[model samples]
Target: MPYQVLARKWRPQTLQDMVGQEPIRRILSNALEQHRIHHAYLFTGTRGVGKTTLARILAKCLNCETGITATPCGTCSTCQAIDAGKFLDLFEIDAASRTKVEDTRELLENVPYPPVQGRYKIYLIDEVHMLSNHSFNALLKTLEEPPQHVKFLLATTEPKRLPITILSRCLQFHLKPIPLELISDHLHYICKQEQVTADKTALNYLSKAANGSLRDAMSLLDQAIAYGQGSIKSDDIHAMLGTIAQQNLFPLMKALAAQDSNQVFHAIHLLAEHTPDFSNVLEELISLFHQIAVSQVITYQQKTDQQITELAALFKPEDVQLYYQIALLGRRDLAYTPSPQQGFEMTMLRMLALQPKQMVVQVETPTLTVAESPSWQEILPKLDLSGMAYALAANCTLEKIEDHKVILQLSANHQPMLNTKLKDRLRESLSNYFKQAMQLDIIITAAELYTPAKKQEQEQVERLTDATKAATQHPKIKQLIEMYDATIEVSLL
Candidate 1:
């Protein structure tokens, strides 16, 4: 016998043999058992997700000599013929080629006739959306009201092109893409059955490269087997798919998490030897960061990798969020740069540069005399406040500080940040700062005030304005602008 491809040889011969389409299988099986099969059925989904395969199994169930059943006896002549694609009653039409109205009309011409061998004359149209509008018009009448012994099974990757008139006459079921874990498990089973020595890592790479298509995964598996000389290895799969190995991804992530710039560059330098696709590298980082974030919130049944668990502990949740966002935006702009490696390096450096700097509030020593009191700005750094509590205190000015009570005035604009929990935290921090218990009162008003935060902002603006003025007055800048007929836009560091 000639060599048969794995996809066709392992094609599902029965509904029970199908994978990753539980709902469709259950519905079709119930329909067969209850004799509630629709005259016209439409299956919609992406390619290689078992739309036509399930349709063939349904045909076998309908025409088996034993009876109409969810489980057709494969030993029967009728079931065997349908499986072999030689059943006289089964008409497998490729709508892509025969899209003319005349072809459709000719096919429907026989719809009124009875079955020659099987119980029903089944018309299975693959890629039915390719049929012309006129062809659809010609077949609408027969499709809607076919004879009792005829069944129409239509499959298409794109269902939107089909007219609503035809769609309404058929029962449509949309198949979902197979999940990565399920695909990997299935591939592992297939390798075992074929007596092939395959590593788990190899199967994982194949499943991910398949992108939710079993047929594509099977075809890639066949190529991997031939390329590896009847073996499946992670290195061979990575070389075949132009994907970076998962182990290599961990070093990059670890360097980023540690904020070690030297290690990050070193990792990239080592990665250059493989000529890896930087875009895929960024994607892998994004995916790993996502997994780490999920691990922090939920406990998975399968234990996460030791490296991932360690790296997850090294960064804060907010830091992970910041890195993930920057990585995604970097990927979007990567193509515009001169080279992908340069873009990827810049992205990683940006993540480290913008790493959320932890706030370290340092209080100056009290240098004032007993009569000279400290201002709210001077007292803010003394208080052990952080996060929202620190923000609330920074935005407010002290109106009065008494023996047992204190009054703070918050600007009307910042009133939205004030809440009961934040107010309590502010009061606690103030009591600790003063080394005494205190009651607190807050009042909101639109009044001119010099909050510590406002003072800091004013100081920053003045410094920037001074720098820009100095740059604008530089003789070199003036000479360059005149010589090149160019404009100088002074930007402050």
Candidate 2:
């Protein structure tokens, strides 16, 4: 006969044959057994997650000669006809193509009629969201109240675009994305059945490349098998996908973790030859970091001989989190740049920039000795924002008493629960060696916590108003006003 792809050839023939959708299958099975049949149903989920497949299977379950059942015998004539796409009663529609109101009106007009030839008539509309508004309106009444023999199975990846009126009428069943582990196992099954020798690692890579889509994975595996001839390997799969070799990323990650600037730059340069998508490289690092993180959490007994053992030893969990943050920022900056390569380089630099500052600044300043006073003069001007924040917590404000510790007013608001979680995190995150501790004393002042309108900037603007008013009347200003017939929209000092 004709050449058959693995996805179609190994398609699930029964509920038992289906993979990675236990919840949906279990629900449908129970519904069938209990005879809790709904007139019309909507199946929603991402592409290649068995939405269409389930619709087809459900069609067989409804019309099989064995009677209405979830586990329809695939050997039966009705089941075979449905499986081979030759069933007259099971009318499969790609709403994406037949989305006009006239088409919907014409087709749905038959919903009132009983099944023709088969026990039940099944209408499977794939990409149901693509139906036009008018078409959906035409379908609404029929779908809500179809004849006893008619079953409408609507499927769409984008369910949000579907109107509530249509959605409300149908019994919705969401077909979820298959898991990665399940996809990998499915690929292995396909390979063995195809009589192809393939490395398990290659299948794992294909599973990931599929991104939770079984149809995509099978299509990819078909191409990989053809490319590998009699045997399939990870290297061949990687090349076929235009994916960068894992080692190309491994050394780069190693250098970044080591804070080896030279080696990191060299690795970035080498990536140019492969023409690797820089964003993909960052994503690879994230995945690697995730692996290392889970590895660190593994107990002694759980440390079986695995490939990630070395990675667990090489990086700390905290370092993994840090690198992930840097890589995330780099990826976010990709769109704003003029050149993708420069964006790529900037990402590298950003990842490297997390290395702790090495420079030490030494400054000498004269000290001032102040006489003892009943109350200290608060020197708020020289205090940095962080320092000011600390002083605000203490009852008394700190004075710049020649860089020595000054007092700040403290209140009950500084108590743990009263203080916001954000402030506590900021307090805990100080340089480990030696950061100034803010001290508190009770000072009666009318000052409130800094507000935007009360910020030093706005305060300065308020002060400059008088000066600006004075300058507005200058003789030179008058002369300029007359010369250009100009009024000062803004007067600059």
Candidate 3:
């Protein structure tokens, strides 16, 4: 016999075998027992989450020889035929493959008739959202008012694309991704069944990579089994998945935490030789920072006398936030840069540069100065526009200005789509620079969209931003960010 792949071999043969979808199972099983069946059912979920599989199981339950029983005896001819995909009453349609008005009409043509063998004719349409708008409308009528003998099972990753009228007519159940622990248990079970030897550490990595997909995790495990040739190792899994092991990531972190750029750069060059994924490195680094943050909090809760004192000295919250931002922006820019090494070096340098400059170690903590919130004057300069454009942006109705103090009234309604937090942040930035006092009051009220007189003006703004970005390399500008930091975002408006 030919060897079957894990995904196919481990496919849930019955509803009881399916994992991570207890609510749907209970509902469907009870519906079968009570005979309270709906004419149309919709199953929606991400890929590898068993939406289609559940649909198939439901079809079997509906058309079994034992007469609509939830648990169909596999020995029965009706259940056997359905399992083999040869059941006359069951028609599985890939809406993606046959997505046309004519195809939908043709399929529905047989729907009006009674089932040839079973009690009901089941139409399972997978990826139903892929159907064209016209095909969806064509099927909507039948699904909304189908013949009593017919049942429609529509499965899709995206249900929003389907018209509300179509959605309202069906009973929708969303299948969730299987949990990691569940996938891990299933993999161990499958390995035992297949007589395959595996390591727990290898399985843990595979579990995370699967991202809550049983089929994907099983497939990975299957590949590992073949690669291991009867033995599984975490090292093999790491190489297969392009992951840098914890040992590799930890040293890189020490270099970063110590702000040792020379060692960090050397390590990066070594990493580049192996073509280490800078994106993943950045991700792992951020995760480590988060771990450190948690550790810092845990250190604080120590009822011991030295605990709270030590926690206060843990990596300052401000510095942790800075490194996170640096790593995040580094990851985003890594995609556009010429090479990963350059992006890696730049991110490290950014953190080092942000280290607080020496301040003569004042004997007493500096008096806390009350800095006013940001105001329009301070913000206009950062807008990256000049002359006329800058003036127009600053004039954002300079409602009031007195001796370095200013009140700029915004057309609150002008850009209703502007994020509320973003608007307030920008407002505070402007107020801080515009005043020597406490804060510049920002009152946002609905305003209308500003109709630019010339379309070219908006075009010029976009062109200017592109030109500015081209002139300023991300890392170079990143160099200027430090303890008190704010990122510049260019808006087309």
Error of 2 at 359 (Å): 10
lDDT of 1 at 428: 91
Q: By the lDDT metric, which is better: model 2 or model 3? A: 3
By lDDT rank, best first, the candidates go 1, 3, 2
The TM-score measured for candidate 3 stands at: 0.69
Deviation (Å) of 371 in candidate 1: 40
Give the range where candidate 2 is weakest over 10 consecutive residues by summed lDDT. 357-366
TM-scores of all candidate predictions against the true structure: 0.71, 0.70, 0.69
Estimate the lDDT of model 3.
0.73
In Å, residue 78's CA in model 3 sits off its true spot by: 1.6
Candidate 3 per-residue lDDT, tens place, 172-262, comes to 9998888888888878788888888888877887887898887789889888998888778887877777666555665566676677888
Candidate 2: RMSD over Cα atoms?
A: 15.0
Better-scoring candidate (TM-score), 1 or 3: 1
Candidate 1 Cα deviation (angstroms), residue 383: 34
